[model samples]
Target: MYVAVKGGEKAIDAAHAWLAERRRGAKEVPELSIAQIREQMTLAVNRVMAEGSLFDPDLAALAIKQARGDLIEAVFLIRAYRTTLPRFGYTLLVETAKMDCIRRISATFKDAPGGQVLGPTFDYTHRLLDFKLAAEGSLPDAPKAEPHIGPVPHITEFLNKEDLIQQEPANDKEPRDLTREPLDLPADRALRLQSLTRGDEGFVLGMAYSTQRGYGRNHAFVGELRIGTCAVEMEIPELGFAIEIGEVELTECETVNQFTGSKTEPPQFTRGYGLVFGQTERKAISMALVDRALRWKELGEENVGAPAQDEEFVLYHADNIQATGFLEHIKLPHYVDFQSELELVRKMRAEAMGTMQEAAE
Candidate 1:
């Protein structure tokens, strides 16, 4: 006999309690502090911040812990928490040229004004797992250098002087916030870039890789990649001046792509840009390439029917939160729908059998 199951509330409560116990681990074990997570799991926190569109490491760390070390779930927690936060004001446009950089490099130039500082990177590291880190210990202190001698000017500014790249208008127009607004079709650069910054790293990487594998392959050179903290300033109407509310670490990437000129325009180099919260260079670089591929139409280049060129494809599938929610929602009750489909198929087959017998007779 089939009996309908009840006590869903009890079942849910039990599951939640089990989850809490699991997250905390045994009472004998030391409690995992938020500070410890923030310090030790910095890379995971960075990804959460980058995707969540928030910069608070501590909060991200807490979210990560609460989500049981699920990075995407941590990002979801941050995004949900961020919605309740009141917007005191918006930051003034951050001047990256004035960024106090920890790492800055350019592939287009041999030597730029800001001498390439290969600050903290894993580019040269061996992939072997460090067993030494299993035991708590400290390494020897490296020699420290004096503060940088002078201000580092942007390499792009040099190209801008000669007008080698397309000149962008410095309009003081206010841009729309992607979080508040529903994304519409034919998005402008501001919206596209904003969506991409919070996009899933793997998704962006795959789309960028597709472009490199001859799917709208526009020869791209990294114009600049920078990682550093920048002051977030907001203009107070009451004070009639901008104030430094806070600061956030950011990764910015700009790409110079080779583009064929159209009938109306002469041959010239074009640009693609990526900017994100925290030190996420890979995500930023991938975003820049994908951004360039999406701009084929605006640049008057031939549409190569690339996945990157498809704005709908890229923007819609980029966000992990949306993708995950829809993907996992299938776990919810669909028995009724399945039953209906099953009945329909059975009836269709029975009718087909009857029709076949009648035709044969």
Candidate 2:
């Protein structure tokens, strides 16, 4: 066992005091407000919320500021704060079909039913940094339009009508909440999705990239990717009906994978789905690819022994908070453990040298 040496309660308190002072750098500069972080650093806030499994933008922003712009640390703070919250009734499943989309597109079809609406995106922008922004220069106002009046049906629906893609039968089973219970192996699709949606973006992205590099070989085509705000509804017992409580920005991706057929089944394309918080297209796309790779068994495909295909491996390591905690623990006091190892190594060395001397004699 490792034991603490010189560090004491006073030292810890002093360290924390220094940390708070360092978090707010320089008296001349204006301090970053929670509102500023929420408004300006929206993407970072969204990531923190998504990974933290909490949808409070304000809380995420505060965590970000308190953590001094460390997104993972912000996520950790948010997660810890989330545990203190009282459990309320669960919300109904969000209907993506009725999403008030700001950005929508389909790579597979040129003329998708909803038509491509390129809402605020960095896809077409040049990589060059704008020097004008260094001084916080203002710019012209972007044009706006009236909100669309109808539902934007999924692109997969059109393909499903032609029986070109596999159909997903509706399952109304209540998904298990991983937070409430300890994670068990052989997790269902719902549990897997829950873990993945809150998983580390970099880890998921890398795992997805591996599949593209012939690790799992799931050829994925972005059938549809849409970003918008969807209403969150919860059933009120007093009211006796579900009512919209709030709206949340979401990024949903549906990837059409390679066709699979067998002696017992007809040829049809498979699907991989991703639904994440905020305008995280890259993360959503990566999520879809990895989701497909993990579905090898369900899709009747042979196990490729890829890391992405291993559900246990992916789920276990995907949580950044857990991974970071385990990794960071190594930095803690290991003095006793180290001394024991040192003594053992020295004894072994002395014995080997004594034996060599006797042989020489």
Best by TM-score: 2
TM-score per prediction, in order, is 0.94, 0.96
Across 1-361, the per-residue lDDT of candidate 2 in tens digits comes to: 3444766999899999999999999989998899999998989998998899899899999999999999999999998998899998799989989999988989999999868888877899998999877887787677765445458999999998999998886888988998777678898888888888999999999999999999995899999999998999999999999999999999999999986686545788888988889888888999999988998877778887999999999999999999999999999988888888888988999999999999999
TM-score of candidate 1 to 2 decimals: 0.94
| Candidate of highest lDDT | 2
lDDT of 1: 0.86
lDDT of each: 0.86, 0.89
Q: How far is 349's C-alpha from truth in model 2 (Å)?
A: 2.0
Clashing pairs in 2: none
Q: Residue 276 lDDT in model 1?
A: 85
Candidate 1 residue pairs in clash (backbone atoms < 3 Å): none
Q: Where is the poorest 10-residue window by lDDT in model 1?
A: 143-152
Name the regions of candidate 1 deviating beyond 4 angstroms: 1-7, 26-28, 144-151, 356-361
